[model samples]
Target: MRPIPHPGRPGKLLRLLAEKYPTKEAVMSRLIYLQGQLVLPKGVEHFMSDLHGEYAAFYHILNNCSGVIREKVDYVFGARMSKEEKAEFCTLIYYPKEKIEQMTAARRATPAWYRENIARCLALARLMSWKYPASRLPGLIPARLRPVLVELLATRPEADAAQLAYQQRLLASIVQADAGAEFLEDFASLVKRLAVAEFHFVGDFFDRGGRPDAILDRVMALPEVDIEWGNHDVLWMGAALGSPACIATVVRNSLRYDNVDVLERGYGISLRPLVTFAQHLYPDEAPIRAAERAATILLFKVEGALIERNPDLGMANRRLLHCIDFRNVCAVLPSGRYELRKAYFPTIDEDAVDPYVLTLEEREILDGLVTSFTESPSLRRHVDFLYRKGSLYLVRNGNLLFHGCVPLTEDGAFCEITYDGKKYAGRAWLDFCDQMARAAYLYHEQEALDFMYFLWCGRLSPLSGREVRTFERTFLADKTTWEEPADPYYRLLDDEETCERVLKEFGLSPKKGHIINGHVPVKVKKGESPVKAGGRAIIIDGGFCKAYHEKTGISGFTLISNSRGLRLLAHQKIADVRTALADNGDIESVSETVELATIHTTVGDTDKGRAMQEEITDLYNLLLAYQNGVLKPQA
Candidate 1:
């Protein structure tokens, strides 16, 4: 067959391909490999949203792949393994080092026990390999053990007793070589990596919970991960950019939740200065409360100034200082005056020309915090990772993954918002916010820094659907005034037409595409379903934050999209790691299938697959160049 030359084939690009491929045979081999990969089953995807720094719960869920590991153990062993044995085995896989320590302490770390568990882990890894390409497994395993694992996995244990004996010899060799622990760790790691092809953290990986830093460390260690920047995440990002308002708000939230460990120890940020200042400033109140009050006042003052400087933010009503009747200790709202709950404004100069202006003490405290937040190595590392791997939204394999809503009006139209003399709504608004957020980090421009705070709580911010009522909730005695109304997007969640409109706005098909949302917790206790818009939209934030357990009626929700279909796992509360290890306790999850694949999903059907196909085409073009003498192939 005569090779038809592809038009506009740049010589430099073809030459670069030639250097890598070398010869026609090399190009053909790569093409064959890619084509084979195309037919492989799509890797499983685990979608989690609104983790809210619940590290222990996040740890278990992530390690267990939302209980898929246990389910697979059951599928593999069935009646041969008792329920207790399966649980123990699964627990070992989930927490290899801890389980090993437990077993060792109990005098249960027999050579036989190690061999048996290692064999089971290998079996599980082999089962997981069925969904992945042959080449993919080696990268997940340690280099030294890759060859041994591949050999053992190649043997059919069930079909051949001789092969089983061969596997037994390998396991025995590992134990005899004092490599049992190492092999088990690698196997456990391999199995977990294979359990989920990719992890999608839809957002809110900060706040409420005690260990967002630890959570970030775990997430950073994962093989594949993408994040949609949550409101809390952006607040931290803005703080990292040295925005005083954002820094104050972050400190306030840490104090409010009593989760300052993430700041003090995790990020090495000292709250001692603030605590001391608070103690001396408000000597009558308890230490923590005093500090929190100090933070709240600082937050309001800085946020109020930020709002005042930017009239475009449309947050004039949120300026709590101006609205406060300090003498009467009342809030002067648009409706009427309301009594203050605490009436504590010790730092405020009531007689000053501008109440929003920060006092000298407050200014010093905020400057220190901004310096700490921006200069802390750990905080900078984590926030940089957020910038590298996170975005406003991600469209992957036909689904729209975002942290919050597409701002919509009550009438189902995209809410038009004017900012910086430009009108934006829907996709454009999200894009603009994302750009400004990045600019805030990269350049620290005043407008971009201010916009970062706006994105944190602006009524039109896609990340924050509801206006934050921090001031009202903190000081207002009237519970009615504390109610922060949600954007119309929340009200229209169940409307299939609205979902379709949103999908269309993002250039996704309504029939096949889903809007995987976060930010709002799914109130399962109140008979609320995570599935909405007739399966067109799904809210995966079942609230991983322990504080929301009572309100959400579950630990969290995780969406698993694999070769066969899409399913949501509503995870029940996990007591602790001790309970899980000692009692063989697992987070009892209720699974709800959202969509079943019409055909088994393959690598050819995924976004990555499309990119691979383009590479294949380029290779074919290179092959034509070689045949036609347009480009010479290297030997």
Candidate 2:
């Protein structure tokens, strides 16, 4: 039947919908389903920040969904299942492929066992996915397996005889098709995905630990995620975009931590050029330590080269080469004149106009490094993912999320800084910086590259809120010079008014939202609090790296936002994942409720809810047009 469009309907959009819906029935069916979904509990989100590589810990936490599996196991089986049984079940959920392989190889699990395990996992997944609408589950499941999974999960308890018979026939078919193990593995993944509806990686997925790319591999596969770029993350980002200053810093750190393989092997970058140049520059090296020191000197030269070319970098303080008294092997630094340690001056030619100038070989090596960073497919792909799913900061579900400070002055005002001849601070400034990051990658512009380096180390940068003190930390004997002053934002973080102002600046309601931050490791053992501003802001970087364990007193933390409320999962330090798993120890976890909702939060209260509401309104209008003869219904 020919129907008239609604008087208020947007023409082009309705036309698009008309082709898909054909008639009002399709749109009405979807609207009815979506409306019902709005009443369901909002899915839980698992938040982790400052991952800093630590692949074992990150991978285990991700696979386990930050102890969500254990909690679910307890909820599903409780005392009925022995501790041993529960532990094995958790293992299956975490390493389904590996566990299945072991069992199959050992002939420990027969076909009957696989069927029983698969059935049990499917049953438990039903409870885990209870919050998500049934329609959504099919999307998480593999297409070929979806029908079997849906049928098994939908089996009614009342129809025991028929359900058992149907289940038996399905199990037989699955076994015959050799899909029993694959089915179990897929079901286990479904449980993990359902348990953690979204992964919010607040920031810092690089440096300080090994195997960051492993986590990156998993993060790319996640259905929903948003990464707030931390200082370290930006450093890598800048390097990946071919910034020599950032590349040098990355090399120095990677060499210092014995993780250059992460850059060379993992990212398919060749550091052999740099090694050859460093060897040529400083010949009489003291073996291993000399290689490290010589490599660091190469980095200094590269960094200095950039600063010399562009004084706008404002890195006069970083001109440490000028302080080098080549003859005496001592430095007259500003803090205090002191002799240098391991004072080697093979590359510093005092007679030269530019001491930071790279040799022909060094330049060649740098060119190679830049090519590796810019041309490698994997490196390009990872950085592209960062651009696609990352932001300087994220404002979601009434909460403000940023990796570092809001960059406040001593008096608790936004510390303004100039960018591209315009002064920027607060939200507008952050947006501008984020835009520059996109421009940096998209256009490969020099100013964008320079800005990316600045974002990595600029003291006034919101991402890097403190003095880097790289030179001082490296060579100076005076501990005083090594002290990098914190931005005034840290002091103001405890002030309610400041928090409110900051929240309002980000266009979030001060009364309704909280600030979630990660940058500095929270010193939980020193009587310091991660929760500040009377719980209006929270810091979740609980020293994910082993390096910070003694200083911050925990391995890491996960901030969970579920239907019930927000909670913090403080994890006990984990030294080894395999040992912990074998012992059924998943980082002794303690959960503390942050703020419980008055009533459990439903999908109706989310940003997604607003989207669904708009869909409902549109569907209703479309239905109205169909009934009122305002628009022609598609045949």
- Best candidate, lDDT-wise? 1
Per-prediction count of colliding residue pairs? 0, 7
| Model 1 C-alpha lDDT per residue in residues 436-485, reported as the tens digit of each score | 99899889988899888988998878999888888889988788877898
The Cα local distance difference test for each model comes to 0.88, 0.81
Once superposed on the true structure, which residue ranges of model 2 sit more than 4 Å away at CA? 1-10, 104-107, 172-178, 283-288, 308-315, 333-336, 573-577
Question: What lDDT score is found at residue 308 in candidate 1?
Answer: 85
Q: How many clashing pairs does model 2 include?
A: 7
| Alpha-carbon lDDT of model 1 | 0.88
Write model 2 residue lDDT over 148-244, tens digit each, in one string.
8888888775578887788778877887888888898889888888888888988899987878888899899999999999888888888889987
